[model samples]
Target: MPKLPAELRGRGGPDALMAAVGRFSDLMTPLLGLTARGRRPAGPVDRSLQVVVTSVRAEADGVVSVRLADLAGRPLPGWQPGCHLDVHLPSGRVRQYSLCGDPRDRTAYRIAVRLIEDGGGGSREVHALAEGRRLTVSPPRNAFPLAVTARHVFVAGGIGITPILPMVQAAARRGADWHLLYLGRTAAALPFLDELAPHGDRVTVRTDDLGGPPSAALLPDVTGATVHACGPAPLIGLVRDAVRGRALSFHSERFTPAPVVGGRPFEVRLARQNVTVHVPAGRTALDAIRDAVPDVAYSCRQGFCGTCRVRVLGGEPDHRDNALTDDERRSEMMICVSRATGLDLTLDL
Candidate 1:
């Protein structure tokens, strides 16, 4: 099968769409506006940092770690262990990747990319870049920060280790008791094993080939210990189930979008534009709205960033994002990852 054009890939972005329009002018003349909408040049940017790729090396099979530094070689913005960088691709696609390098290395930032053969083109574009390539990136923003605790239980599954690697180092630096449970399909496929090896018994690297899927038995006792997990949904779900009904706090970051419940198509009314668009079961409200008004604000369509937030005039919203507080959800919703709870929704737009 032919690969879909980058413009039509992922949740859709204005820049790539416009770039496509310029190339196939006659065929996509009607979609010229879509290109403008994807750019959203008038929209606000959360972070603006210019950096160049200093190095790119394979950490494991299909996993490449990239180091970015300022052109002037000055200190970039400071970031915590669990913070992530929003890389703006040359194709106008934006992706978020965790910073896995040493936090003390203020001169540059490091991130690892794992090629997802079936994913949107962002990872493939990043993996294709050679050294000396320049890109715009957002200063680090952390939704998953390491909390203060006497002990921490870090669970990382495959590429999810990107963020947890630093947390484990931070835990070690602070002399806090911490245990890392790393899981993968095989030992060679896991990145940063050499770096983690020095930790000795504190880190347990397991693979499906050796044992099996991470079971509740492998999970540590969470009593009085803060549990931080990042991985595929199943592993996070397993940890959540294991630590349920306990006083310990559980923090997790998911690479996938939230599952839609009651996936019936719904109608969305944009109050200011006086337009109503139908959001199909598998599509997001953001996509539907953008189809009508291309300039709608959004960043991190996964709902981590509140850029796409809008007032909910009427209708219950199926809140899927991890960013919003309980109070914020009462009136506002992130249109990117959220959807209408019923047959129709009225938005401030």
Candidate 2:
């Protein structure tokens, strides 16, 4: 038997390696079969890559930036300004972090995490990572893509600046008219201020400690510029309200899952566990299921990462996630952001 690399050994030893190989074989079965021709399969497939953390540095109060590179020193995949990586932690917890480093630098990818002491343990796990720590991450996925417009207005709040930083850099390189409104609860909590120094006056720094709180008046004139905002829901809402009835285009991404809009109460039956979970209006099925199944996996509850996808054995699904394709929607649904259209749904669990 050939020796497997350390990165491929995984925590489950040989058994895990064989299981992974089996999954890969299954994924390729259709492609190699004569009836399939050369067409690829529908829906997403796991193409996670192993990387070693080369550097970790504190970017601000309770925030740190980590740099990861391929274990074999090979160039990683190229990503756009708004792209993010689904990082799998050693504890089997998955989390999404925006790719903040320069796209031209393919040797390594940078991601920042802010400590959320009271929230899930993902950020805490990331903060504990040290140099040379190994991690598996999904290929870069972009939910918020920057448009190729002449003028751009960016609004960033706290850690939300991670994705906006790369967009601002891209806009400057293109010689497009751009300005950034970087807001934080306090100046000390903001990360990557040094990186934005080159942009000079084009960047606006406003902290709640210094200036009460951000309002529509603080927003720059977005008349002809495309507005890109990412931050707390309130900040994004302010920008959305400001841009309403205007001639400009608006895009925004949230750090948290969007509030359930027009949601109706529904019940989800876990077939394997023989249990049923009730999802109330304004609450996600993921949350309700976790009450019965504590170890359910999920990341980026915003519905773009596809980590919480479950097989729909019966009932109609009100698919609201962006990760799944039409083919996937037929049999599977993302339980994090998507819900049932009817009163009940049966899940594979």
Candidate 3:
């Protein structure tokens, strides 16, 4: 029999150790062909739901909205405005897309994707998908939830409008005082304009071509409103700067990973592999660990997916992700965006 990692020998209590053992068994089943007594060897169980592409509509220059429905015409799982789904592509790539359609509609779920020519290939695959194509997707998860406020200020940039659109609709239905400032490079590149038409003057459209690049001064007065912004890092930074020392609450969601504000070089010890890797001050631990363990799972490198999570055997982690709860942080870390506080840290691997 093969030896187990030192941390899994007797530590982590019975439930934790058993969970780790089960994960190990799942990992090893493909390589070892192990099975339960008197049962045939089986592949990993896929708990994701099966959905078929119902429609594909071009919303803008480089953006397209894809509608997904259950295979048997049954109602899909309910979701909120800021929720997103983890879509598994045919090329084995997983990407998270915000739920953009009306939450009251249970017949199907809608997501929009923007083509990135130089990106990691997920968007291109989504664009290539045809109607009737089957897909496996995880249930909707919300890392960004709408706050219950009497007044709201929404700022959306380009494709970032996907999640905010539903929020705007919900706010209007509830008769809340809300406004949206939509920004993009060109009017032709902006999406879902017809949907926002009913709101009239409450929605303001700004294009770089018409009025130069955006600045913090263009934002409306967020005096007593809850401000929600989503966009590129620069736009989010502007929102943060505008809300600093203000009386209102500010929340933001980003398409890119948060930059390492105060990072330092550290050493990571992978106990199972008995290897040590150096993490540079400018690089993430995920990039370094992937050099040794190429099969490490990761998606949405933005630190919101929790797919790159690993068990921490030792050392204190400076958690930077928005996915994990306070309790989960005690024994787990998302290596994609998190780092160690001290000189060295250890992982179960």
Q: Worst ten-residue run, lDDT, model 3? A: 1-10
Report the number of the highest-lDDT candidate: 2
Q: What is the descending TM-score order?
A: 2, 3, 1
Candidate-wise lDDT, in order: 0.86, 0.91, 0.89
Between prediction 1 and prediction 2, which has the larger lDDT?
2
TM-score pick, better of 1 and 3: 3
TM-score of 3: 0.78
Deviation from native of the Cα of residue 323 in model 3, angstroms: 4.2
Model 3: per-residue Cα lDDT over 1-349, one tens digit each: 2344455566644455656776777787766555644255677555588999999999999999999999989999999989999999888878899999999999999999999997767899999999999999998899889986899999999999999999999999999999999999999999999999999989999999999888888888888889999899999998888878763798889887777778999999999999999999988898889889876777877777888899999999999998899999999999999999999999999
- By summed lDDT, the worst window of 10 consecutive residues in model 1 runs over 32-41
TM-score of each: 0.75, 0.86, 0.78
lDDT of 1 by residue, 54-85 (tens): 99999999999999999778899999989998
Question: What does the lDDT read for residue 238 in candidate 1?
Answer: 88
